[model samples]
Target: MTEHQDAQGQHAPTTPPAEPAVKSAGPSPEMLELAGRMFDAARTGDVDTLEAYIVAGLNPDLQNGKGDTFLTLAAYHDQPAVVEMLIRVGADVEKANDRGQRPLTCATFKGDAASMRLLLAAGADPDAGTPSARQTAQMFGGERVAAVLDEAR
Candidate 1:
């Protein structure tokens, strides 16, 4: 089929998208994605993979989109081995997520007694962060977990 054209036989001019005025000084998207997977490893108890990354120089304190550190996710998900490995490597147990939820609080929220005990033994402050572990347990009816938190205080 024949198409009509301008009498001048000229194509329309278009401008390409403009680049940002300044270069980003943050980690590249690829690096961020890899870090996210490491956080997932912590949550899912992929101990071997997670340990390998940490040994390979991945920051043990890597935070997810919600600012949840390795310890927070591992404890919240009830991954005892992962939590122990993280504690051994010196990951901060007190780092709260964006919502101000700490690893201990997460454990209590999930009623994970094992993680609560582990975190408490590792020196996690039971009273840190908003809705502290004790408060979370009491608020959520985590009687058993509450008992563990009480012992830590």
Candidate 2:
């Protein structure tokens, strides 16, 4: 046993008891709620709110439970402003979800030619994910987007 000075500066035979280690309980409710809001922003084209969150240290690449990212939701909903903002803020354009779907696939599936073009311009892989953007376009009647993807190649 080592002697230590106490509060009164007197030598004591024992040291103060060590603090207990704090156990993690994972993300708090507030954080989960905030994440839900951010996902909603992405899905609803709330570019201002999403931008604010991203600016306030929120990771733009944070994926949801099933691995779908902000960019995926934005592209899926044809939110041009949100997509552009996510791309400019370093979101992964080629990231695939748990279901092996990418942002480009979402845009292609909906035949959102504008979104497909934007994603392609941002380096989104047309051939990425389980159903490649090309395959998705073909399967979903997105001939226009398919043509755009071809042109991008």
Candidate 3:
């Protein structure tokens, strides 16, 4: 019997070596470009690029230099669907920009009923402000937003 053999035993089957786990690649220049693209897409309400980026794992609440998030830009531009999408993706609806204007307040000042409705439904505070949403709406003569303010009481 060979030294490799045990009593009445055939050669032991060798265990296969374990494979190491591979990690996903880190962010590259291309990813940075993709983030910038998503930010612009939100500004224009470009649904295709926005959806594509979201599906590809870009965060919906990404902000620009002015601290304006995607949702903020969508509200500012009166893009209701984009606003809804951002809200659905957990964007901070009440986040203030560099000017200290909330998304809802900006929507109110611009007199966008659709955006206002979306923001209100997302629990944005109509009465919460330095220049509050209610006051901004009143200043801009936004009857719909003013009505919203009244209902919040």
Candidate 4:
């Protein structure tokens, strides 16, 4: 037995007791309500309502449960006009969702050349890293998107 052994000859290990798990502080009620309204606005393509909400101090970069921004939702739902509006209101076009898909990637994946054009013209980075909008366009066989991105290079 070591010199630090108990009288009974068993070595005693010294360590502090661990702390109990603490409760996580989730989103507030107001943030939740605002996020729901933002989702509805994006889904319904209600530009007026969305503008009002943004003007009233709602975040333009608000995301849903899937970590999809309003711009991503607008693009996925084929609401090009709403996408434009959100971009004008300062939405992050290059923002990725949980799947690492940006708004441009969603539009390109859907083969919506017009939407892709708009986003590209707005300075959305086509060369963003892996699973990028440009790569998604190529993967989805969007010849027009590839041509356009190539031209931009």
* Steric collisions counted per model: 0, 0, 0, 0
Residue 128 in candidate 1, Cα distance off native in Å: 1.2
Candidate 2, residues 1-153: lDDT per residue as tens digits?
A: 689898999998986778779978899999999999999999999999999989999999999999999999998998988999998999999999999999999988877778788889988888889999988888884566679899798
Off by over 4 Å in 3: 1-32
lDDT of each: 0.86, 0.90, 0.79, 0.79
All candidates' TM-scores?
0.81, 0.84, 0.72, 0.73
For candidate 1, give the lDDT of residue 133. Answer: 83
Model 1 misplaced stretches (Cα beyond 4 Å) = 1-22
For model 2 the local lDDT of residue 83 reads 91
**What is the C-alpha lDDT profile of model 4 across 83-150, one tens digit per residue?**
88888888888888887888888877776666677788888888773577788877884677688666
Q: Which candidate, 1 or 2, would have the higher TM-score against the true structure?
A: 2
Model 3 C-alpha lDDT versus the unseen true structure = 0.79
Model 3, span 37-153: residue lDDT tens: 887888788977797777778776676778788887888888888988878877788888877888888788877778888888889998776687888977884677688666655
Per-residue CA lDDT of model 1 for 1-153, tens digit only, reads: 234445698655555678899998899989988887888898899999999889889889888878889889998898989988988888998988999999999988988888888899999988889988878887994567778988886
